[model samples]
Target: MKGISSYADTGRFEEISLASSSYSSILYDSIRDRPDFKAGLSEQAHLAAKFESEAKYSVLNGFSYISKHVNPHKKWGMLINLSSFAKDANLSLHRNCIYCSKAVDLNINAMVDNNYNTFYVAEKTEAGELGEDIAAMQQYPVTADTSVSTLLLSNIKQGERAIIVVPLKKKNFSHCMNFIHHAGDGIVVDGQQNKLYNFNNNADKKIFDSLYGAASSAIKPARIYITGKAPDIRNEAWEMIEHPYFPDNDWEEL
Candidate 1:
């Protein structure tokens, strides 16, 4: 698990020990055995409702209206940000609370929109191994990890092509969970070393032409890269992850 950094020396956040891996049985056990896990999940749900209510109120009243007098927008934003951190804490338990679970090697990422303070978590899995049960967990009220939708945006420009590299190691991605609360832009890459998957950007191909040109000259190319404008790349990525279809199975709910 990743260490929780103190925010502005306020010391509001503290680290809790958690299970080490996200194997299926371990996830099941944590939900069953860990009182803290269930308690945190419930707390997260509570915060989600509060945050939603505040957001809905702000939308109806106008953020500018709140910002003008009491600055409730800032206050609510900070509260929402804190809830984001709380969600991370709860998610950590889900992913790494058990002592005997096997490590699942894969990557998952959430694309964020800074302007709207929104998160779009990618629905990544380990090559679909026993994934149906877990995928359905997102929809089941009892099993949903609320943090999936509460974290920070990547602070990306509306049209720029950005990549949040999600390595196989869970620790590497854990810290990124709180990127929004810390006011940081999560990893932005040019996609040089990482293979660009599902390209939807329409940028100049020369963006990567030089790098690939040099690589191909030294060795036969294993794959080709292309670019395009990904105006809705976030939506596309989410749709692919949340509604994954394996010809043999349909979308099953918990």
Candidate 2:
């Protein structure tokens, strides 16, 4: 008999046992079952084996395998080409990396002077729970407009460092939030707009406190920045920078 049309190889067909069904009902139920049940004749097992082999080799080459446990709907669980995953794996394998923790733990103070430092994190809200925007930044060096969904992704491409930002306090930041998040590590909040009096008055301390707090939270090394007058943090150990914005205000203080 001809195989189902949806099967990759329509000519292929698998044989099944009818021992569980009466001879009279065997043919009828076999025909009534779902297409996939009857379409199991293809070389799916062989294909899976081939994919596993490729996945292993890719891993040896610094590629990472993400188990499909996160989302089973995806066709493949292992994402081989993304540098972010590779970096995570590589960092974990480092002797001094401890437990191979996420880049979040790498000390920004030590890396502040390093030219290749590139990792950014941003706050992601979904269903009122914190999520990750790492995936979008992972596809950096984006080229060609794809869709509104990929707007963040299309703006970046591979071979570039990862950058993300999470605003601790403020609203009107969504417009430039993505840019800042992808620009570098750190927090950038509107002191004036958010009515962040303390932040405006103690920018440097706020910046230092932010990084110190993040590191204390078991987070990796991070860079913190603000867009207003900030007092200098005494004996500050992290990389902090001030980039003033919205200069129309007359209440300027260094």
**Per-candidate TM vs. native?**
0.18, 0.17
Query: Candidate 1 lDDT, tens digit per residue, 164-200?
Result: 2121111212111111111222212211111121112
Residue 230 accuracy (lDDT) in model 1? 22
Per-candidate Cα lDDT values, in order, are: 0.20, 0.21
**Residue-pair clashes per candidate:** 12, 19
Lowest-sum lDDT 10-residue window in model 2: 92-101
Cα RMSD (angstroms) for every candidate in the order listed: 19.1, 24.9
Local accuracy of candidate 2 as per-residue lDDT tens digits, 155-183:
33321222222212111111111111222
Q: State model 1's lDDT.
A: 0.20
TM-score of 1: 0.18
